[model samples]
Target: MSRKKRIAIIGTAGIPARYGGFETLAEQLVRQLGDKYAITVYCPGPKYTKEERKTSFQSARLKYLPLQANGLQSIPYDSLSILHALFSADVLLVLGVAGAWLLPFVKLFTRKKIIVSIDGIEWKRAKWNRLAKCYLWWAEKMAVKYSHADISDNESIQDYTAVRYTSLSHIIEYGADHTVQVTPTAKDKEEYPFLHKPYAFKVCRIEPENNIHLVLEAFATMPGYTLVMIGNWKNSEYGSSLYLQYSGYNNIILMDPVYDQRKLDVIRGNAYLYVHGHSAGGTNPSLVEAMYLGLPVLAFDVSYNRTTTEGKACYFKTAADIAAIIGNTRLAVLRENGFRMKEIAHRRYTWEVVARKYDELVQRVLNNKGKIPVTPSVATIPAEQLISYELAHLQAPTPFYEKR
Candidate 1:
């Protein structure tokens, strides 16, 4: 048999997927594609201690670098990974735009194919400073332009990139199959008394863009509706202050990040409703995992969230909107919505489906020469010719999207 193609995964916080979406995606990719390809994953050395670190994970080779995989350090972390992967890997699968500044050089200097997944519109987030935002904005541009192929996790993001860069971005969303519907144990219920009651649940990073305060404020007004929210409460000043303000309310339970998957799933999967306050990012893993557990979602009214749930789940723009939605929505209607969400998740969000898409992209990039735009073939035809054929509508430059 011929040798398998070598693949390098970069820009994640290291696998075994303890962190967030990108790391989960990397783990799933390795699990799904390891047999078909010779895979190597670049990991953050600082996260794993010498005793915890292994030379290999699953069937993929693991290479660790002494740098953090996020924040300002991510630039050098990802850059070094890319430079090292260039020597042996057949394709470089980068998960973010952090190291994108080096892509143009890679494109010009090397024959290796680069596939980048811009992890949402990072620069648009409220947490980033002006300088970080500026750099990320420029880096996102570079990643889209220089990479052989680019992936978008949501349709709205795909539309954004198509309009901005005039390139077709492959839509490959996160999988929720790893998140199981856990039946809370006696100990679980003892620790989380909210398990006995019909409560709304939410889990995400404690960031301004997530609209955590808005969700808390909404729940605070409706004392009857209990809301249990889990996040990194001490990670920032904003999070700490919110925790102080909201924790006093008997109806709202503010807790720190729950890294234990089983415990987290016990609380999350049993909730009557999933409140998604995120106003940024595309196809959030937390939201999809909730859907997979057949939980009805009350999400922030944004294009990304709307597209992810296919407009089937209820949405809210403000604290009043959230309170109004929860107050008026009946349990029967919520149950039906939960069914629809589970159906959508089963059909669209699974590791098998996501992995197959990545494999297909790898195959296509290996054979293809350059990026292709989403612009219709008819757009290439002259205006006079289109007028003659009475196909002017087909040649229109704008793509129609549902107003958010």
Candidate 2:
């Protein structure tokens, strides 16, 4: 009889997917791949009590660590998970760069395969302090350089790793099929009075990088539209200040975090438009979820957002930009954009497709003795060959092209 390959999924809040993107992805991976592999997931002890902790969740073993899965504690938390996996797991599917400092020892000492997904450029988020950012920056490099195989959730992130580490990163985005477009029931309407009105909606971490203040300012200035935004307003002083500042506006609704999936979906799916203010991260789960819900997105102007929407959605860089867009854009045009966004999501962001990609990559890495071939950098390509492929408009001899 053949034995199943043991896979350890590390660096998530844990399995029932109560938290964010990593948790959801981890849960979906187990559901999709558990039949073929012997899987175990590590959960944060702080989030789940002793009674809540289970031996297994959805056919995968659950191991709890007595520390937080995020913040400064994550460094040691992930290190412990990696050390434990070293004994029994054949493959360590690490989800972030928090434990990257230990990967060198794991690679040098063991035959275990390390597959990492850096989960966007964590060091660049404005929420992190200078010291935290510096550690994350070093960790990000180590994660890529030491992994057997690496993944980037967006092409923009892939380009970054390609340029910085000169490594080939597999692109695998988050799935949105789990987000259902729901209709509000009478009880739901009673609880959320805004459901009866036409309104714009947003849900994200209330961080400076997400441009939450800018979104709030836009809606506050434009009284013609009602905006409902849900987030962890009490998490930081910045969030609390913004919530207090914007809470007074009759047209603006500052909501607390909503964890129930159906409740969130019902509010999100019924929006007239979805406002995505995130300026960092690759393939944001909220933006894609909004797309899957057939909501027109008005996103912050960033390369990552453009790549996710394929340059099809409305964009804004400032409060005035957002206000102008909302005030001027016609409803029919917005709905048309929503249709295009949904079509793109349905074709690419399903969990089945994402799982298949991960399965193929895992199998290929195992077959090759847990090593992925390094791809050549674009700088090595001949200049004349690059010039030959230029478009007609860009073919004209200029200072930029003269080197060729």
Candidate 3:
């Protein structure tokens, strides 16, 4: 590119990140590549707070709008950001699939390049009802079709998009550098009683896709094994129900959401076993962070999880499977697996490396080098058959998708 690409990054929650993957990615991008790219980040404005009156934040051009992030408001918030960004910026690197409806209009009106990441198979999340799933599916399709370059954060996501859209996706995942091993302070020992115990650790949003119920169930039954799980238990009925169900168990410990990195890292880094029970999406933030910290992984037996562990860590599909591993898997075996997990993290999942990949993709998108393959002839299948197959595929059917 001739000069620093003026980039307008949309679809993330906000900067000075204390939330999830997209926010962390934004924060890291500004630190690593801000000098090379002029960035404008869209933030959700205070519709309800005393501090909501404050507009901009930090070094980047912060554009705040009156919309709550991460829900139904995500559509309008991202739509507003994309529409506003079309006025300036050389490239629009939209980080999620929320505002894909405006993508065609952006292309028709301007020569600005667009890059989108349909963040993990979002529609498959169990929190969404059937109607929301349909919208997310459409948005995912549009994001792939309209963007100058589409990113798949994991190899499984890359494979899924390639098979469905016949478009090769650029793979760039969230990095796991935030968690680190910490020698416990005297104050830390005073607060957390479980710091001395041989405990299993997990932290995630309380959702069905995350399989919090399963993890809790397995830990509840086990007598000697101590399990500590962290999440927002007040967010939903499901979370509240799970909390009520498992709160009395002797072996299980449930903590509310904690954003303090030093405290959270101490908890995560000191665990004997890291239990990950996520059933949907690509590479998960918590799972990868545990891997980075050299914790032995006992992940759910999903293809995405399997791929992330590189076929080394132990996998479980049921409560019985989790229990069996917990009872039988030795510390020596786990340490060896943990060593391999750490090696994998070092090789491919660092922020500096992820930042470099994003920068390269941004340059490619701006240069018009990320091209889609030629569309193929439509398959000679009946409409009824197509609908039936699509329905089955959405649930559980044969390999409905092929690598295109």
Candidate 4:
């Protein structure tokens, strides 16, 4: 038999999936594709201690870089990883667009295939400064333009890319089957007394773009109900301020990040409702995980969230909206919503499904010559003829004109 093709994964905090969506994606990809490919994952050195670090995970090799995997340091971290990967890897599976500025060089100088997942519309996020946003915006363009294959996590994002880049982006969302339902033990009850009562649960980075403040404001007024929110509160000034303001509420429980999967599942799976406040990003792992656990969802009113839930879950656009929905909705209706979410998750959000999609993309990119565009045959027709034929709607730059 011939040798296995080498795959290098870049743009994650490291494995054992201690962080957010991309880390978990990396771990699952390794488990799913390790047998078929010689995979090497680049991790952040500063995030792991000597004891936690390992040379390999499962069948994939692990390489550590000195720079952090996110924020300002991510630029160099991803740049260096791509440079190192060029030596021997046949393909570069990039998870984000932070280092996409170098992708043009890679495409121009090297023959290695690039399969990049543009992890949401990063430049549109509120956390980045003007310069950072500009850089990210340009980087996103480069990532889509230069890669052999590009992926979007939601249909809304795919539509956005089809309009902006005129490229047919593959839609591959994150898997949530790794999240399990757990029963709270007697000891767990002692540790978390809130487990005995009904509460709305939410876990996300304490970012402004996530609409955390709006969620807190809504819950603060609902003194009769409890909100158990988990996040890294001390990591940022916005989070710290929210913690200070909301921690004093009798009905709100603001807790730190719980890395123990069982403990988190126990708290999350037991909640009566899951409140997803994210106003940005596509197909969030936390939201999907909650759905997989059969929890009812009240997500923010946004196109991305709507696409993820398939317009089946309740939505809130403001603090008043959240308060009114929770205060008025019947328990039976909420339970039914939870069932709908679970059905969707089971059908679309499993590791096996996601892995197979990635495998197909990998095989295609390995043999493909150039990226495909979703531009329609109608686009090639004369504009004057389209107007004369009453087909002017097709002239609009959107995915609606894509071939059926």
Candidate 5:
């Protein structure tokens, strides 16, 4: 009998993911792969209580650290977790670029396999200051350069890495199977009166990059259309001001973050349409979850969102675009969009598929086979030639070559 491989999952807040994408990914990976691998997960003490911090979760061991898993402290937290795992684990499955500065040393000194997921292009996020963004940018380079395998959650991110780092990043998007299509109970309707009405729903961090202001402005302009947006309204001054400004609107219901899974699902699943304002990040978990709930998405017009939805959903670039779509789009079109979105979600965004990809990548890394070849950063051929030859569906030349 062969011994099971030892794996360490680092960079998440904790198990029983209370928030965010990486945490949820970590949780799902553990649940699916626990039996096959001897997994040890690092939990940040700030996020989990002493009572909640048992020695183990599911079949995996939990190691608690006395620091926050996010922000500046995550650097130390992830570094310490990596150092501790170096002694015991065969593979270090790191979820973010927070402690990527230590990866070069880990790769140089230890035999442990380092697999990293650069959680979207973190440096591009509007929340981070210039200094923080610089550090993140550097860390991202280090993580990609040093890791045995790198992951990108969306094809757009993969394209970015392929062009920037000349690295072949495994595309493993977040699973949406965890999200259920919930019917509002009488109690649910009593608790959330907005459940009874036809409204567009959105739930995300109230950040500048997410375009919360744009969504609010769009809904505000059209009094007939209702918008139910849930987020951490008091987390920042921007969020606070937005809440104050929009909460008074009869059509726009600005609610605080709702962590309860079923409660959130019921509200989201019952919506007439799901509006995704996020302009950053790759394959947002919330967006995919909405697709799983059979909701038509009105996503921000961006390559990342387009890639995630496979260009099947509606898109908006501005407040007016969103407002016009809501006002003009027929219910039948919305239903068709929802069905197509659901089909895409069912085929691509399931945990079983995601876990299988991870498992394959891990095995390939451990075996020292299927290593990504070093490719030149620059393309040899012009964009016009490549598109003309590769894209058979394009009847006319691409807009870039149309003028030529």
Candidate 6:
């Protein structure tokens, strides 16, 4: 048989399976594409060890470098990974835009197929400073432009890329198959006291984009339902104050990050309703996982979310919307919505399909197939046309509820 596609995966904190989206994406790629691709994954190693270490993972190669996989060091670490991967891998399937500064060099020298997924709109995030944002924006442009093929995880993202870069992008979202219906163990309850309770589930970075405060405020009023949100709550004054404000409330549990899969999935999968208040990011991995497990979704009613949920799941834009959703949307209706979300997940967001897409793209790019087998001159939807779909359904302020 012809040689299997030698593939390199970069831009994750390496994986023996943790919970982050990049890691989960890598894991799925390995799971579904292992037999078809000779894979190499770059991992973080100790800088001071100053020594040799075994390189490889189960059925795939591992190359460990002496730098953190995220933050500033990610630049050189992923850059180095790509440099090394050029040798053994037929395709470079980079995940993020962190190491994109070096992408030009790779393009200059190698015939290796380049496929990149610009993970959300990284430059628009609040975490980056002005210079960082500028660097990231350029990096994002380079990643999309230089790559033999590019991926966008959400339709909104695709729209952004197509509008900005004037290039068609592959829309490949995060798969939720990594999540299992795990039961909380005895040790889980010891670790997390809230594991025993009936609670709503939320896991995300505590940032303005996620709308954490909105979720907290809405949940604070509801006494019957318990809310358990996980994030780096101590990282900011906003997070700290919200935690302090809601800590005394017996119904709300503001927990820190839970890295263990079995421990976290139990609470996540068994949640009464998965409260997804994320106002940013493309098809969020956590939200999709909740959908995959058939948890009732009440997401922020943005195009990104409405598109992710296929415009079928319930949504909320504000505190009142959230309150009305929880109060008015009956349990049976919630269950039906949960089923609807799950049906969408199983039909559209499966690892098998994702892996197949990646595999096909890698092959197509490797053969230099210029582009996918779609007509180049199709009628593209305008921005206003895209937004009009949701605007038509947007609920307006009720005049009957006016204070006058």
lDDT tens readout by residue for model 4, 275-300: 99998899999999999999999999
> Model-by-model lDDT, in order?
0.93, 0.90, 0.85, 0.93, 0.90, 0.82
Candidate 2 deviation (Cα RMSD): 4.0
Worst 10 residues of 4 by lDDT: 395-404
The segments of candidate 3 whose C-alpha lies over 4 angstroms from its true place after superposition are: 1-3, 47-58, 372-404
TM-score of each: 0.97, 0.92, 0.90, 0.94, 0.92, 0.87
Write model 5 residue lDDT over 190-292, tens digit each, in one string. Answer: 9999888899999999899999999999999999989999999899999999988889999999888898998999999999899999998999999999998
Residue 336 error, candidate 1, Å: 0.5
State the TM-score for model 3: 0.90
* Predictions: Cα RMSD each: 1.5, 4.0, 6.8, 2.8, 4.6, 7.5
lDDT at position 368, candidate 3? 79
Candidate 4, residue 71: how far the Cα is off, in Å: 1.6
TM-score of 6: 0.87
- Give stretches of model 5 more than 4 Å off: 374-404
Candidate 1 C-alpha lDDT tens digits along 265-340? 9999999999999998999999999999999999999999999999999999999999999999999999999999
Two-way TM-score contest, 1 vs 5, winner: 1
Screening candidate 4 with a backbone cut-off below 3 angstroms (N, C-alpha, C), the clashing residue pairs are: none
Per model, state how many residue pairs clash.
Answer: 0, 0, 0, 0, 0, 1
